[model samples]
Target: MNRLFDKSIVLACCIAAAVGLAVDARLVAAFCLGVIATSLAEVAQGNRARRASETASYVYIIAAVFVPPFVPLAPLAFYDIARRVRREHAWVALGIGSVFAFALIADLRTDALTARTLLLTAILSVAATLLSLRTAQLEREQQRMRRTRDELQERALALEARNRDLADRQDYEVELATLAERARIAREIHDNVGHQLTRASLQTEALRVVHANEPRIAADFADVKRTVDEALQLVRASVHALNDNAVDLSVQLDCIVEGARSDGGPQVELEALAEHAPANVANCFAAVLREALSNAMRHAHAKTITVRCMEHPSFYQLIVTDDGADATPASSSNVAEGMGLASMRERVEALGGTFTAGPRVGAGGWRVFATVPKPQGDEDR
Candidate 1:
């Protein structure tokens, strides 16, 4: 809209300069040529077309000197030159000088160098050039402002996203601290109160034996022992639940490998734990891994062991392998079912899973593998 308004001002000035002038065939031809040059300059979009339009406009301006009827179109050439030069003040001055030179040549050729003619031609051309130059400068300033506004908007959005991430991290740290406190309380109850209760129950048992001849006293002591035993069982269950809820699969696996390494045993490595498993699955896998490590170190005299726990979309899998050579199943179809292995197999099968324990196919090591399928609602997990 601004560009159209600017061009309209130049056109109005051109018309004012041509007032009181007579219309003829030359004037109509000049107007048609001016429209053609403006169309090529404004509508076409290439360097070659712009150069062609500029060249044609200059030629038309020079030729119009002979035809006074072409006076209204001459200022359009100067306006276009100002627009092309944009902010180059020196080039705009040079263009105005060329206009005076063209007028002097006109005076040499014909007696058309009247003061009135020179004023209308030179003053109107200057007005059009000034208007075009100022309009170009305003357009460039507007474009720069738009680019700066867009960059600021992008930076604000990035800062907002960073703030959200920081808030989420703070919340996560608080949750971890709460879980750790619960686990610490559970451990304290198990270690301190649980042991005291066991000792009390044992003392009551010895008192019962000592008071066997007194029926009433033996019966009272027996009730006390039963109560103490019940309390101990409850404490153990509470500790187990607290520990299970507090520890995720990654931490449990880490503890398993690290505990084995710290026990003056062989080198143990926890290779991978891809995703978190459910509580029951995690507890089962931890148990299986502990049993496997014990068998490897004690029975097989393994020098190294590796463990992995992976959670798939439909199931959870645990793998334990050790560089042990004391696997004895050659005559029994590789079916050495001991109490530990049987316990591990039963735990897995109870959860609708499969278990395998034997020597590796092409290695001198025992491998224990278990996989438990997810429940119906958790299959997509």
Candidate 2:
């Protein structure tokens, strides 16, 4: 549609030129000038002084109508002047209106063939100019809408970022609270249950001494054993709290037993003789002991598993051996297989130590033994 309108406008300019050449040049030129001035006034008002320009626009338009013909290019000259003045529709309206006025002036002369041409051209130009203006207005509106859409999209992205930040903060808070709760529970178990277990164990030892020959005195020992069992359970339940983000040998051993029990395996015996051990040696031995026991219970199907933790001046050795009364569920000899033995090896070796696990030499059994290097400062302690 725009192409058709532009073509029509060009054709109108051709006809107006022809008419101006044929008619009285002075009259046509004056009329063209008037048309240019009117268009300039109207165009200038597009974003400027509207009321005053509008009134001037009417005056110029009337003058264009009253002027004579033969002013073929006069309207374009006036349009150029308006362009220099930075008016909006000046050049465009002058292109169409000047020709229109010339056409009307030519119609008054019945003998002039040029007048007929100008009249026809003027009609086409007017139609084309109106169409062009309407299209331009539509384009402006579309541009505005697109800008608004872009702004909305940016706002949405910002909102999404803010929501993600809030979610991350919430997750952090939850993790912090969980850690805090674990710490509190661990303290409770150690202070309350641990003390009670120590007292009960002492009492049981005392009773066994007093009733050394009496078979019935076993009952008193059993009562103390029950108390120790309860203490262990309490410790297990709150062990995560006790972990201080560092090695806790006792808790580590208990965890291993718990995991083995969950797998429906045989029971385990953990023997820790820390009375002659340094604190570091005690902790590392406990870790190795648990790993050894876990492997025995899970892979060896041992009826009786024993973890013996012993410490020396330079290092600590954890000896875990089991009676292989029951064959392992898996028969493959992949020493580095499902047994947590490899992971245990890595842990001990990382601390500058050695670890070994394999079938026992004497009988149907499996054993895991590890030696952990002692820290320099821990040797004195």
Candidate 3:
């Protein structure tokens, strides 16, 4: 807009000068044609229009040679040539030389060779050329500023991403420190308080045994022994609770998957590991996953194994499947039971859950699935 406004002002001044020269009707029509052609040449963008504009520019120069009114509009031609000087030096020289030739021809033919007319042409041409050069310089400055702004914005985005990473790392460290502290506390209680309680129970049992011949004293010692036994149980339960609370299931499962990956045997992917699972359930699922992977590696010679665990409202479920071609089910539809399968079954059954390991129906793979009901205590928690 600013550039166009500058050009508009120069064109208006040229028109005002033409009016002062008392241009007749023919001169007015000639003036309009030259103005239209030169303006189109100045603003033309595409190649086709630019070619047509160049032709019009030539026509405008030719018209100026015959029409005296067009003498003032010579500045537009000079401005266009000046703007292209850096890109087309030879064309600019030719264009400028043509303008001088046309101006000289118009003056000689019209017999109006005045000092004022020459002075006016010189001043307007210089002014229009300066405007073009100034506009080009401004555009270069704006481009530089845009590049700097874009670079600064990129740096700012990178810094923000780094800050987010640092924040996440800090949060993980704090969580690790908290878990470590809890483990330390649980260990201290087990070693100190639990040990002391066990010793008390043993000592009381000895007293009860020693006083068995005396009815009254034996009864009293037996009661004390029972009391000490109950205290010991409470201490053990408290220690277990502390340890369970410290367990991070996600971290434990991640480590298990990472260790399995290091072996470079069958590819292992943890399909899922459910959240909000009790510590015992998490441990059981992880153990089942490890056992299944081991069996697949040794006997099944599986290509891939997938481990999935989920905690439902009523039960926790685990599924470990493997694509082991060598270890398909027998004709009777029974896969041979192994010690590892037995252990997993026992673990789940002990927790009031069901466990199954078999050749996947309608598939060329083995599937080990287990589902344990949510413990009463865990449900309450």
> Which is the winner by lDDT between candidate 1 and candidate 3?
1
Q: Which regions of candidate 2 deviate over 4 angstroms?
A: 1-113, 206-230, 233-237, 241-381
Q: Tens digit of lDDT per residue, candidate 3, span 1-381?
A: 656777787788676555546557866776677567667866889978876876665556556666666667766765665555556456755675566766765585666644466566667877887897888788789999998987786566445434544553465457557667878998999999888988888887788888889889989988988888898888888777767643556667767777877566888888554666755566667667766776776668887988777656678788888899646322112236544566677767867889988888999889999998986766654
lDDT (Cα, 0-100) at 176 in candidate 2: 52
lDDT, candidate 2, residue 61? Answer: 42
Candidate 1 per-residue lDDT, tens place, 183-236, comes to: 899989988999999999999999999999999999999999999999999999
Q: Clashing residue pairs, candidate 2? A: 28-69, 28-70, 28-71, 29-71, 43-88, 43-89
If the candidates were sorted by their lDDT against the true structure, best first, what order would they fall in?
Answer: 1, 3, 2
**How do the residues 50-159 of candidate 2 rate in per-residue lDDT, one tens digit apiece?**
54554454444444455434333333333323323325756655654565566465555744435554554455435544545565566668889998887676566445
Which ten contiguous residues of candidate 3 have the minimum total lDDT? 326-335
lDDT of each: 0.74, 0.56, 0.70
For lDDT, the strongest prediction is 1
* Candidate 1 accuracy as TM-score: 0.58
